[model samples]
Target chain A: MTTTIEPRSGTAFKLGKGQFLEVVDPQGQQVSDLLAFNAHDTAEVISNGRTFDYADTIYLTTGHVLYSNRSNRLLEIVRDDVGTHDFLLTPCSQDTFRLLYDELEPHQGCFGNLAGVLAPFGITEDEIPCAFNCFMNVPVDGKTGKFSVEAPLSKAGDTIVFKAMMDVIIGLTACSAPKSNNGSFKPIDYIIHDHLDDVA
Target chain B: MTTTIEPRSGTAFKLGKGQFLEVVDPQGQQVSDLLAFNAHDTAEVISNGRTFDYADTIYLTTGHVLYSNRSNRLLEIVRDDVGTHDFLLTPCSQDTFRLLYDELEPHQGCFGNLAGVLAPFGITEDEIPCAFNCFMNVPVDGKTGKFSVEAPLSKAGDTIVFKAMMDVIIGLTACSAPKSNNGSFKPIDYIIHDHLDDVA
Candidate 1:
């Protein structure tokens, strides 16, 4: 199944074991926050901290495994068009914008988008975990120990794919941080393909 | 309702808005990991990063608010018998034990207890975010930039209370890190009181 998450919006879909989900950055300079939860158990959701510890890298690319809080592998990155993805930062929220930019306007953020999209699954805002920011440019300065977000390096149609290790629920948000990029947001597409039959 | 979670075990319960949950270290010297999820929306669950940033303190005490990923307030610490709490570390998992101790035997850890306790609620390991390590003595050294876990300072019957800002599901794990404390673990009790009726 395929889905398109519009700018400032979010969507959720299920990927059975042996299935692969490919997320496409339809337009360059857009960041997508991807979160996943064990379909059989909501408590076993993706954990950025564990993933980083397991991979021993701040940046994620193909071959990296997204580990859950229990240190279990949930998804494995099987393909990537853009090699850089951020697993260190939490999703952008209203408070982040308010505290950093002092902009009081109700701007769209990944927090709200994830909450809305997962609500149908009986998931609430408090259940939202840190997400993997794909196609976003966040560079760390080794000398000063500082990091800054820049425009994405991916071009149109750039893609990243992950194979589900178990039945899982995936949530994606087309980040609406206008200032993070070129003062505009764009949509992203995702496709989930089942390969269980082939494995059988 | 009241529940006593045995040492190295866990329990999950829900508290409505205006209700308060009190956790008591009946035997003292015990560390408990407290995790909260928005009962209405799990995606906005408590976030240690946001809470620390909001309170501007590494330690949690009375009057501090536990903020969610969406930056929404989830719970407020209305009372604290032991003022020190660690919000900087993730719960200990089997992987952590293996990596640190190199002991291959099955060891009890906060991650497993949480997953088991919240299983009935469909919560899995991935949903367990960085926890508020209640009564756990993890002190950071300013000179060496190092921290070590020590035995808790709280005495028997020491208690901490949190008033729910929203409907919330709380998970508590009696940490099973034997070496972190004395050579054994102790149980903890929790009581939930509905204050909404009193308010009305």
Candidate 2:
């Protein structure tokens, strides 16, 4: 069944091994933060450091595998239309707004959304690691080693698919941070497909 | 007073505002992992994301400021001998050795050491965030965003100094990973000096 996650909100659900998760960008420039954890053991969650160590590139795309904290293969990027992504940032939080923005009303960012949804699965805010940001643009300067977040390069109808390598719990968000979504927010659409063996 | 952190060991201490912390590479080619937290509130710790966002550079050096999770100024780099450092990596742990190395004995890495010392200060293993890796070298590809951990460039007696911008608890280590120190581990030396105001 297809599911729509409203803007600035998030959800966590179980995904079986070999299932394919399709994340679609219904509107251009919207960013989504994705995370995966072993369903049997929440401690073994997605690790950007491990993934980057093996992938040999931060600009991950189709064919790259995501690794867990314990170095187990978690998911594989089976398909991707928007190749630009970010792996260096922690999910933005309430403190992010207090620190970076001057608005009178502060919005709890993606970290808050993820934390609220993942709590049911026994995960805490402090346990949230660096997220696999789908369709986010962050470019780093070679000489200065500085980086900045820019508008995503994804267009409307862009989609990315991840094939689960193990039974996992996934935390996903329609990113709430304004800068991450080019100063706007929009819902994200996704659907899951089970492998033939699981169906049988 | 001068304190020497034995090879692959770590320590934690209290640092008052305006105090100067001088971390020295007693021998060349060693790396140190440093972390800071607000003394009054452990929840407000050093944040690489915030520091990088405001400093506009990941190659932190003299004149750069390290920011806390709450966006408070924590430390200012007052002096530097080796300019290259890493802020993108979590402290290496036993899992790191198990996954990346083939050693018969997997030493609990810097993460273990930091957890041991910082626990007394009310900080837990999960609370430990990305560290300021002193003297470590990690160069990222501008195009690929992939980075590799390289041997440190610090020479014997090389020193880097930071002036605390707030009263903080500090966790520091003489790194255990062979790759960070060019296959050899050595001691790290440090000294703390109080400001004139503190003395008065």
TM-score of 1: 0.62
Model 1 complex DockQ against the native? 0.12
DockQ in order: 0.12, 0.43
lDDT digits (tens) for residues A1-200 of candidate 2: 67999999999999999898988888989999999999998978887766875676768999999988666899999889888988777677777776667557778888889999999999876567778999889888977887888999999989889999999999999998888889999988888887523221
**Candidate 1 C-alpha lDDT tens digits along A60-155:** 788889988777889999888998776656677777778766787966588788888888877766667778888877665433223566788889
For each candidate, report what fraction of the true interface contacts it reproduces. Answer: 0.14, 0.46
TM-score of chain B of 1: 0.92
- lDDT (Cα, 0-100) at B121 in candidate 1: 78
Considering the true interface contacts (CA pairs under 8 Å between chains A and B), give the fraction that model 2 also has: 0.46
